[model samples]
Target chain A: MIKTSTQNELIQYVYNELADDACTQLEAAFMHDNELAEGCSELLQIQNLLDTALKSPHQRAVQNILNYSKSLSLQS
Target chain B: MNTTTQVSDSALVSLYIAGNENAFEQLVNRHKNKVYTTILLIVKDTYTAEDLMQDAFIKAIHTMKSGRYNEEGKFSSWICRIAHNLAIDFFRKEKRSPMITLEDGSNVFNTMAFAEDSAEQFQVKEDTHARLRELIQTLPQSQREVLMMRHYADMSFQEIADSTGVSINTALGRMRYALINLRKKMLNSNIAYDKNLYSE
Candidate 1:
C-alpha cells in the first residue's frame, strides 16, 4: 500500500517535480510494488482526463479577449 | 517579426510594449486557452470565467504598460498569477462553492444517459467523460484549487504557495490529497484506467 509520504512523492513523480535520486528510487520501487504502480496509473488517468476534457474554452470568450486587446494602446 | 513559435514569451511582451498590439495577440492566442481553463476550473461558470479572464488580461496589460511587471522574466506565470488571484477574489465575493453550472442553469449530470453494454464504444467513452467531469466537481475545494492551479497555471508549488498564500508544503500536500481523492472516487465509480485514454 502507498503510504502518505509515498502519495506525496507520487504527485511529485507524476509532475516530474521530483529530484533525480528520488525519482530513480521511485522508479525502482514501482518495479517491485504493485500498489505503487496502481497508484501511479490512477494518478496518470486523472491527469489524462483533465487534459483531454478541459482542453478548450468558449470561442466567444476568445473573441472577447482579442477584441478587448485590440482596444488597448501598447505604447510604453 | 519572427513566427510566434520562434519568439519567446518575454520577447512577445517586449514587442507589445514597443507598440505592436499583435504581439500581445500572439501572447493571448498562445496562452488564452490555458488561462481560461485555469479560471474556469476555479469559477465553474463559463461567462464569469470569461469575465475574469478579460479582467486578467486587462490587468496584465496595465501592469506591463505601467512598468510594474517585476517577475524578472516568466510572463506566462505572471499572467497566471493575476488570473489565479481574480478567481480567488470571485469566490470570496460570491461566498459559494464552485458548482458547475450549465448554460441554462440546469444540472448537466441529471441529463446523462449511460450507454447500454451493447452500445458503441464511442458512447461509453462519452459517458465516462461526463462522469469524470461530475467527479471533478465533487473534489474538496482546497484540493481542487491546488490541483487546478498546478495543472492549469503551470505553476510550481512555490509559485502556487506565493499566489494562494500557503506554504509550499501545504500546496504539495493538497496536491497529494487531490490525486488520492480522485483515484478513490474513480475506483468507487468503476472507471477503469484505459491506457488509450491518454494516448489517443
Candidate 2:
C-alpha cells in the first residue's frame, strides 16, 4: 500500500515538479507497485482535466491592453 | 523590427528600456494570454479581469520607467506576479469572497446544464471550462491559489512559495492537497476527464 508521503511524492512526480533523484525513486517505486502506478494515472488525468478547463481570455482584453500600451508609448 | 520569436524576454526588456516602443508591444503580446488567464482564474469575472490585466501592464510599465524593474527574473513571471497581486488586491478592496459559490450553496456544478448547441464543439469546450471552474471553486483558497499559479501562471513551486511567503514544502503540500482534493471532487461529482470532451 502506498503511504500518504508516497502519494504526495506521486503528485510531484505527475506534475514533473520533482527533482531528478526523487523522480527516479518514484519511478522505481511505481515499477514495483501496481497501486502506485494506478494512482499516478489518476493524478495525470487530473492534470489533463485542469489543462482542458482553462479558458482563453477574450479578445477584448487583448485589444484593451494594446490600446493602453499605445497610449503609454504616445505619452512618453 | 526583429521577429518576436528571435528575441528573448530580457532582450525585449532591454529594447523597451532603450526606447523601442515596438519591443514593448512584442513583450506584451508574447505573454498577454498567460497573464490574462492567470488573473481571470482568480478574479472569476471577464470585465473585471480585463481591467485588472490592463492595470497590471500599466503597473509593469510604470515600474520599468521608474527604474524599479528587476532584470534577474523572467519577464513573464514578473508580469504574472503583478497580475496575481492585482487580483488579490481587488478582492481585498471589495471585501469580496474569492469563492465562486451560488445561492443554494450546493456548488455551481450541480446547477450547470451541459446542453448541446448547434456549435457542438464550442458547447463542449464551454461545458468543460464550467465543470473545471466548479471543481476549482470547491478547493480551499490556498490550494486554489497554488493550482492556478502552477497551471495558469506557469510558476514553479518555489516561485509560488516566494510569492505567497511560504516555504517550498508548504507550496508543494498545497499543490498535493489541491490535486488530491480535485481528484476526490471529480470522482464524487462524476466529472469525467475525457479528452474527447475537451478537444475540438
Candidate 3:
C-alpha cells in the first residue's frame, strides 16, 4: 500500500496544487509505481466526471442579470 | 479575432470595472456553469439556483462598480465564494432538506441548445449531470461541502481550509475521501440496474 502522505500528494498532483519539487518526484514515481499511477488515474477520471455534472442556468435569467447591470449603468 | 482564453479573469474584471460591458459578458459566460452548479448542489433546484445566481452576480456587480472589489484573489474563486455563501444563507433561512427530487437536469438544456444541434448527445450529457448531482446530495455534509468548494468553487485547498475553518491537511483529507467516495458511488449507480430485467 502506498503511504497516506503519498496519496495526499497524488490528490495535490491531480489538482495541480503540489509543490514543484514534489510534483517532479511524483512524476518520476509514476513511471515506476503501478499502484500509485492507477490511483492518479482514478482521481482524474472522477474529477472529470464531477465536472461534467455542472448545469447551466436558463438564458432568460442571465439576460435579466445583464439587463439589470445595463439599467444601473444607464442610471449612473 | 478574440483573446478570450488568453485573457485572465483579473484582466476581465478590470475591464468590466472600467465599464466595458463585453468584458462582463465574457466573465459571466466563462464562469457561469461553475457558479450555477455550486449553488445547484446546495439548493437542489434549478429555478432557485437561477434566482440565487442572479442575486450573487448582482451583489458582485455592485461590489465591482462601487470600488470595493478586492483584486487579491482569483475572480472565479471570489465570485463563486459569493455564490456559495448566498446558497448557504438560503439554506439557513429556509431550513430545507437538500434532498428534494431533482427535475431532470435536461430541463435547462435549452440554455445552451441554441449553440448545438446534437439533441441526442446533449440530452445524455444533461442526464448524466443530473444523476451526478443527485449522487452528490447523498454524500455526507462535510464531504459534499469540501467537494463542492474545491471542485465547483475552484478554491485551493488553503482557501478551502480558511473558508471552512479546518486545517489544510484536514481539508485535503476530506477532499481525498470525498473523491474516493464519489468514485465508488458512480460505479454503484452505473450498474444498479441488471441487464436480466430487460432481456428478451
Best by DockQ: 3
At residue B2, candidate 2 shows an lDDT of 64
Question: What DockQ values do the models have?
Answer: 0.47, 0.46, 0.57
Model 2 segments more than 4 A misplaced: B1-7, B20-23, B103-118
Docking class of 2: acceptable
The whole-model lDDT of each prediction reads: 0.75, 0.77, 0.83
lDDT for each residue of candidate 2 in A1-76, tens digit (9 for 90 to 100): 7787787777678767788999988889888899999989987888877766654555676677667766777787
Worst 10 residues of 1 chain B by lDDT: B104-113
The DockQ assigned to candidate 3 is 0.57
Give the Å error, residue A34, model 2.
2.4
lDDT of 1 by residue, B1-200 (tens): 67545688989888877778788888988887678767766676667877898889889887777777775747777787788889889988999856654333233322223334335654566566656666766888888878877877777778878877998778989988887788788889998777654333
lDDT of 1 by residue, A3-74 (tens): 877887888888888889999999999999998998898788778776654535556776777676666662
Count of clashing residue pairs in every prediction:
0, 0, 0
The total number of steric clashes, by the backbone 3 Å criterion, in model 3 comes to 0
